[model samples]
Target chain A: MYDEPYRWIEAVANRRQYLDDQFIHGSPLVGISCAQGVLLLTFNRGTEKIYEIYDRIALGGMGHPADLEKLRFTLLDMAHVEGFQRSPSDVTASRLLKNGLAPVIKPAFEEIMRAPYIVKILLVELGTSQDRDHLFTMDYDGMFAEQREFGVLSASSSSGDRLSAEWKSFGVVASLSSALEIGLRLWGVASLLQDSSTSPEVKIEEKDKPSSTSPSETPEEAEVTTRIREMLANETLECVLLDRESGKMETYRSLGQSDLQPLIPTEFQPAT
Target chain B: MGQQGDFLQVLGEQGYDVERVFSSHKVDALHASGMVTTGTTVLAMKYRDGVLVAGDRRATAGNVVMYDRTDKVLELDRYSILAIAGVPATAFEMARILEHSFKYYRRSQLQDLSFEGKLRALSTLLKNNAPAALSGTGTVVPIFAGYDLHDTCGKIFFYDILGAEFEAVEYAVSGSGSSTIRGIMFYLNRWSQRTMVELDEEEALTLVLRLMTSAAEFDSATGGIDTQAQLYPIVKGISAEGVRSIPVERLSQLFSEKVVNHV
Candidate 1:
């Protein structure tokens, strides 16, 4: 029905609205760069949401599992081919997103006849130094941004902003445990933001909110912590690290439950 | 991709040919000159803890030494090692492919490639290079060793130029100096007080150094320890924990104290 130019624009806008609705209940992911390396943490129902794409590159995403898997394989292929043709160090998050995934994703999204990918991905590349670490977030519509220190992918832009603000106050942590704690705390905030029916278009002024740097949690943070505790009983906490100090060819490793046990906040631990 | 966890298949689809890349004009020129760069004398044996793999630091071209600091034993992943005894160019390329393939399979499938799968992967590469191998241009006879996490023990497998894999119960040897090392190993295993499996880490390392010395005495291609330059063989251990390289410092101390004085 999108025979006219205006109709095609309207169709694309409608597709965006439909995608937003599908992502209303999407799980949130937090990727933080620290001295240890980069930690990507997400609370998922079962299937893995974090992956190692290359030696130094990792991926975390929220959306349709099928779409996510497709995107993951595409990235894996591109990264390996690039690494083989050129060099392993040549594979970077910026290059993969800008030159590889973005171009592929943008077209499917614009083509009304083709099924657009229902996914949002955060790609992290561990640099030689902590400050040099690169993170990129790609949207379903093929929009992406290069970030430093932290990257967040959530249901709504507002929730992403809330998580970003929370992460900024905490800053890049030095240890995996400390970074994990911050990631969990940000996950809670993202849950609160996604749970609330507030319009993402409405920007809540940061000054109006309680100072996030305060030691105590906001009321919403407390509620989300309880929510997380209950959800943890059945859901699995997936965390993968691109460890700079691994000193091995492949640096990606998924954290085991035992590894995460002590680091998990007492308030959020699921009953064994 | 269709969930094909085969990295070489992925590479093949992208037009990668190990034989074509290896058997080129440079190789032809080298063949005409009778100087093909070859790596020599790689061996692996079971020890008390796990497996110890060693390779002498030499790359040869006919009678001339092409390079002295060549590392023939390559770590394919955390647990797996590839020790080649063939054309250095072809062997190095195989190692690189294997390194990428293991990581690619693990990342794509979200699980480590099984021990049997790892073995087959190597066989497949060798089989694909049959043309080059049969032509005497890029023949690679390799010994593979790794800690089998599932089997809970160290295992060694050796492959012929035609890609036939055979499990070595105690030890395996390859390369130009292999005949001398192989003959000594057969005698030692039969007459020695302790088998190769019963030796401790230090004993295993000492035996390897002695073996290399003996191999070099008989085979010119095997460059034994370069004491003048303080260069020793590359020795790596694979165990239940993982893989670790024996530092040059430790090798030095062991050579000076244990191998030299027979302590």
Candidate 2:
């Protein structure tokens, strides 16, 4: 008996961009945009052997259910019923739109053209949030921009423009310390403008604050705490800082109260 | 007498006369007819790492300094060296003959002659010339130093005019000025821990020059360092790395520095 359910689970796990398990297999695709914004098309030999079109704008943030469903049907239809094989010629934007699937995919496309916020949110979620280096930002009408440094996707064209301009002005950082500072400041500004709950704040302790008199504690420990406070106050961003030495990245949240000493080099004796 | 009878002449006919001089205890007979020359001073001292072999560079014919630039020290082979004294030419010839003999033996046997073997060879060569020495023709005394790879340390061999060989424990000296040189070196020996690591190339050279200077001052046969020629005492260091003669320029610099500070 054919194990349809198990095969379907494996396909879903493999087809998705990310996989936690090492045993799963996945196919590679080169998603490019020429005329009709940027579109992602999957080519899998085991499953559907056809170019399935995905609207960049429509699937920006949280993808539209109707758009995803129509894409799924198109893929299945090409694989099973029509048995439409994808040659090199079938990969173009004109060929995809000329196919029968375009009519069903048009509504979600219009929605993305009206709202660019979905794209920005999707990019911020997938691009900056992931440990890997893969981010795609497609335009409203369908133009693609591959970002080498940082990518911004948004419904509001002006907001995306502002973020890109600001990021470009900062330029490439030579050291990790400088990158962290710049990234945090940009994220902080973005959070403030978006009115998000992730805004960072500096905490100042008064001179009269009660000090613990533990006999076991050394003076060096107290000095370290003070130095950490100074670094937190000086930090201008709300972005994650990656520890190059330990190869670990964490959210740049002061309230999380994680140890940051590992990120600081031993050569640095933080000044009061 | 016929021509053959001329060859069989008496000691007086050959201008050979035996004279008596006081030894340490009593009178001893020594030849006095021929040219009187002070015997050379040669010494070999066993140190922790290796042996130090030195010689005074003074060749005298009676009261006149015949040769002031004599190099009495010689490297016999990889492991051993010879330092000569007595008649300069005779001593040098003996050194050369022994060096050749050692080379010949090493080539034939495909192995190096040991320190003791080298001493025996030198004594054999000297024994062949005993008749000439008794007739006041010439005499040579040499000190041999070598690093015994089997023993893992340095060894020194001292010889007398009669070709009698003796192995010294720590230090040995031969030559007319050896007593004075030995006296200075004895004090230095006490300070040095018989370890080869204790004395480096610089310290060894310094010690040798100091001893040489003291010997030159007291002994008429021991000549002073040639400052005009920029020639200092010839110093060679032998270690596991092999024998290397110190550069004359470096020795001259060291000698000048020592001389300038002497007020």
Candidate 2 residue lDDT tens string, B115-222: 667767777767666655555556667787777777777777787777788888877787888888777667666665653336666666666677777777888888
Q: What is the per-residue lDDT of model 1 for residues B1-263, given as tens digits with 9 covering 90 to 100? A: 72778887788778876557655343466665758887589999998999999999988888888989998989999989999899988898999889888888988998899999999989988988887887777889999999999989999999889999999999999988899989899999989998888899988999999998888888888898877798899999999888899999988988989888874
Report model 2's TM-score to 2 decimal places.
0.41
Give fnat for candidates 1, 2 and onward, in order. Answer: 0.64, 0.00
For A57-155, candidate 1 gives per-residue lDDT tens digits of: 999999999999999998998899889878998998889989889988999999999999999999999988898899999999999998768888888
Give every candidate's TM-score on chain A: 0.88, 0.30
TM-score of 1: 0.93
Residues A1-272, candidate 2, lDDT per residue (tens digit)? Answer: 12477764564444322211111222111121211122222212323211212211112221333333344334223322121123222333233323533444333333422321111111211122223333444432234444545543322232444455555676655554444333333333332222211112211221233363322221233343443344355542122222223211111112112333443334333455
What 10-residue stretch in candidate 1 chain B is worst by lDDT? B22-31
Estimate the overall C-alpha local distance difference test score of candidate 1: 0.86
